[model samples]
Target: MTRCRLCGSQATASVVDLGATPPCESFLAAGQLDRPEPTYPLHLRVCTDCWLAQIPPLITPEETFTEYAYFSSFSTSWVEHARAFVADAVERAGLGPEAFVVEVASNDGYLLKHVVDRGIRCLGVEPSVNVGAAARDAGVPTLTAFLSPETGSAVRAEHGPADLVVANNVYAHIPDVVGFTRGLRSLVADDGWVSIEVQHLLTLIEENQYDTIYHEHFQYYTVASAIRALASGGLTLVDVELLPTHGGSVRLWARPDGVAGEPSRRVADVLAREKAAGLQELSGYTEFSARVAKVRRDLLRFLVEAAERGETVVGYGAPGKGNTLLNHCGIRPDLLPYTVDRNPYKHGRYTPGTRIPILPPERIAADRPDYVLVLPWNLRAELAEQLSYVHDWGGRLVFPIPELSIVEGTS
Candidate 1:
């Protein structure tokens, strides 16, 4: 039996089983299609002891992230979010030229570039060699290494403790939750703060965002579970913010234990909300498998019906979450002929198991398909605005998750 990564308990209850799926980010080149691709069980379990929803690490970090393809800079909304975060954090923390900043999983220096432009000394710790090299080229000094207790200590020793440590959307990628939190804590000065952004488990269940589950994300954390995990590493939750990014995420601000920072009222508010949502009990997760199964059936039915009518359907965005959704629903190039992405790296590549051809966003305007399946449903508004020209050709946008819906108008 696989033990819980957070509480080390064998009382892990199976929540949802997505069968088998290949690594979501493993986009394939045309030449590599003849080779065999590996897949692993995509099962999620919740620890009865700690209520931490997680899956076993079937693949190593090196296999999933070492030479990553997903770069944060590709998303315009995400870059704007990063800029806003840098501005607010710098002012709130009273950061200046003397104050040092560090960002973990700093993909392509998207956020740190804002900090650097402010004349602050900042460094990035990114494990992806390609993204790290890109960050360096973008004028952000970065170390291409995975953050661990040892690496964190070394970074602290080499560049002094950080006044603000930012870890955006990276807390879930870690298998060792406690160790990762400890490493984050180690990088902070006594008066420093650590901010982590993660997609909230409550939102995942309520919104039927099962697509977010994949091999790379080991754990799905509730506010209560996050607090326990951080406390295990001697960190205290000082504040919490509900962010609309990534289908509803929570940005948590923490400080070392015994610090004087008062806990924000928002922290208690979120904890209460999670408890009321049944996140603290196993029953809360029991009905998720049924919900996920319903979503699969609903999405497949829509696509199959569309195919029967001889309507052409394409996809938008090549996000990792979209890969899980497509593979789970057994969608192929037939159902979704090809997907468009802003990232040039993914252009001309095929999705991992589904093998859907990825093209540049410009292809959408050229083909003008009857329907465009917005794969990254989280960015529906932004994509709708960007692809408004589709309406000119009587093309409608479709969202497959949270119940498949056809949207006609652009926001």
Candidate 2:
């Protein structure tokens, strides 16, 4: 009887069970393949009281993130996203030289670099030592520690309250949603604002993005549930924007409770949309398990047929979501052969469970396989453009999620 992390209620109902899986980020070395790998049950539950979809934090943060392999700077599109965000945020907030900014889970200082370039004071809070070292090397001041109430207070005492606190794609990573939101409230000045980006639960269900579920991500928040979680820490939502990144995400702008100014119409509109989508009720979640199971069967059938036809297949991008898809479908090196990634950290490693070798993107052109499975289906357009050369040799791209489809000629 696990209690809901947000509302502390026992009315949590099962949403979907993904069986036992290893941490999605746990890539393996060749030498370690023979050793036993640990796995945990990957089950998601929806809180009837608050409607927060979440999984229990069976794995500790230290075990999953202390020495992370994923670095934000490795992806060109992601870096561009960060730059655009910094440019817009600075201008929108009327920021100047004296303004202070802090970014939580600031991996490799990808976004903070843009702020520092503008001659503003900024600090990065990152938990991974490897990524933090890279951030320091890039001339970004960073604190290699997890953010909590105590750490937030210490940061405030040393550097004063931040004018802007940016938490992008990190709201779902925290195990203690209440304490984490409180820490966020403590770091911002009374008049300052906090901006949070999280993948919307409505999009996840509608788009059939079950691959995003893993041990590292604890919660999937709807606009209504997100408002409740933040309100517990005395924060109030003032604005919200929908972003196309990571399937579909929502960027929320919040201020301390009792602050002047009414919430924008966008906030009310999004909440209404969520309610209409049935995110506020349990019936909406009951059918998801069947959808997920259908995806697994459909994908496996495609891969097996491709193999029977004597067509060579490989994977593109070694993202965490790809790991979940591969492991859930019981794909192995024989089916996928190997995958390619732009990140050097994962280049020489193998994916967990499936143990498919990961190589550099250049190998795709050299091998010229018949079919390339675009594992990170959310970035299909970017990947299609980058790998357009494959079409020269009659190679087509395949997307497994949201139904299997063959994409031709970069479209």
Please give the lDDT score for candidate 1.
0.92
Task: In model 2, state the lDDT of residue 100.
Answer: 98
For model 1, residues 306-380, the per-residue Cα lDDT tens digits are 899999899999999999999898998878999999999999999999999999999999998999999899988
The collision pairs in model 1 are none
> In candidate 2, what are the lDDT values of residues 181-280, reduced to their tens digit?
9999989999988999999999899888999998889999998999999998889999999998889999999999978379899999999999888888
Per-residue lDDT of 198 in model 1: 96
TM-scores of the models, in the given order?
Answer: 0.98, 0.98
Of candidate 2, the 10-residue stretch with the lowest lDDT total is 277-286
lDDT, model 1, position 307: 95
